[model samples]
Structures are given as structure tokens and as C-alpha cells.
Target: MPLKMDAAALNAFLDQAFEQVADDFVVEDVATDRLTVRLEVSDKHLRPGGTVSGPTMFALADVGAYLMTLARIGPQALAVTTNCAIDFMHKPAARTDLLGEVRLLKLGKQLSVCDVLIYSKGQEPPVARASLTYAIPPQ
Candidate 1:
């Protein structure tokens, strides 16, 4: 699929809504069929053991899938995450950025399902994976 919103446009749209959005997070790259989001590693995202917390990780997956859906379906700000299933496979390097690549698994009239893989930037394998579902408002 061709992208309606490019990396810059998508980032701008997200920035408009999430002013408090983490500086560590970025929509690094985007396409109609795929997107890459990054979380700039920061102290706010770390847990007691110096690892990224689950909530923080969830944010990455959520935003990644959320934006991909909006990118594909058009700017539907009303669209919200309905469900999220994430598995943390390993500890992320505190010094490296995290990346999330997401693709639409199912796009429906009222809902969208996305599969996301979160990786430590420059890593060959994902550090975590998530399947996110969003509820799209009626036209």
C-alpha cells in the first residue's frame, strides 16, 4: 500500500496530539503498508534495574500500531487502542534506541489489528513483539 502520510506528516500529526509525548519516541519511517517507530532511550523509560519498564515498552507498541492504523485508514483521531498483547523477550540496552515495525494484520470497518515487532536499534532480532487492536470510529 502507498502511504497517505509520510514520516514527516505522521510525526507532525502525533506531535500535535501528544505534546507530552516522550522525546525518546519517534515515527522514524512510514509507508502505507509499514512503519518504523523509535523510542529514544531516556531515564524516564527505565525501571529500577535499569531496564525499560513494561509500561514504557507498551507505549512504543501502542503508538506504533496506532499510527500505522491512522496512516492506512486516514487521520482518525478518534481511533483508540482496544487491546494489546506484548511479550518482552529480552532486556533492551539502555544506551541504544528502540525501534518498532508494525504492519496491519486486519483492517475492518470498525476495527484494525496490527502486528508489531520491537527491536533494539541496530539489533538483528526483536526485543519484544506485540499484537495491537484498535477501534475505529464510524464515518
Candidate 2:
């Protein structure tokens, strides 16, 4: 399927609708079934060990999946996460940004399933991997 929105449009939507954390995430690319997002690392996103927290990584995956769904389905704010499972594989590199690559596996009428892989910037192996299921709101 074709994309209903692109990176710039998604970014604008995020700015208007989710202003609170909009600055933390940037949509780097949007394609037919995938989206790339960057999480700008900051002190608040770090834990005591100088690594990005689990919650922060989860947020990146969740938001990346949500935005990827919206890229395909258009602006449906009510669409919400139904289930999420994540595996923290490696420790994230300290004081560096994180990158998320989200791919839509299934886009059905009532649900969307997405896979998110997160990596520390300039790293090859993924720091975390997540599977997210979103419940698409009724029209």
C-alpha cells in the first residue's frame, strides 16, 4: 500500500498532537511499510549506570510503531497499543542517540502488528527488539 503521510507530515503531526515529547523523537524516514526514528539522547533518558533506560527504549519502539501505523493509516489518534513485548539484548552506548527501525508486519482492519529494532547510533548490533500490536480504532 502507498503511504498516507511522509516523514515531514508525521513530524508536523507529532509536533501538534504530541508536543510534550516531540522534541525527543525525530522521524528520519517513512516508507510504505517502515519508518525510521531517532531518539535524541539526554540526561533524563539515562539511568544511574549512564545507559539509556528500558523505559526510554520502550518509548522509542512504541512511538515508532505508532507512527508507522499512522503513516499507513493516516492520522488516527485513537489507535492504541494492545500488546507489546521487548527484549533488551545489549547495553546501549552511553551519551549517544538511539535509532529505531519499525516495520509493519500486518495491517488488518482492526489490528496492526509491528516489529521494532533499536540500536545505539553507529553501532551494528541491536540494543533492543520489540513487537507491538496496535488496536486500530473503528471508523
For all predictions, the C-alpha RMSD in Å is 1.4, 0.6
Residue by residue across 1-139, what tens digits does model 1's lDDT show? Answer: 5666777877888778777883557887887678899988888788887877888889999999989988877777889999999999988877677889998888889998999998888886788999999999998
**Residue pairs of candidate 1 with colliding backbone atoms:** 24-40
Compute the lDDT for candidate 2.
Answer: 0.96
Candidate 2, residues 87-109, lDDT tens digits: the string is 99999999999999999999999
TM-scores, all candidates, are 0.93, 0.98
Task: Assess the local accuracy of residue 101 in candidate 2 as a C-alpha lDDT between 0 and 100.
Answer: 97
- Cα lDDT, model 2, residue 110: 96
Write out the backbone clash pairs for model 2: none
Candidate with top lDDT is 2
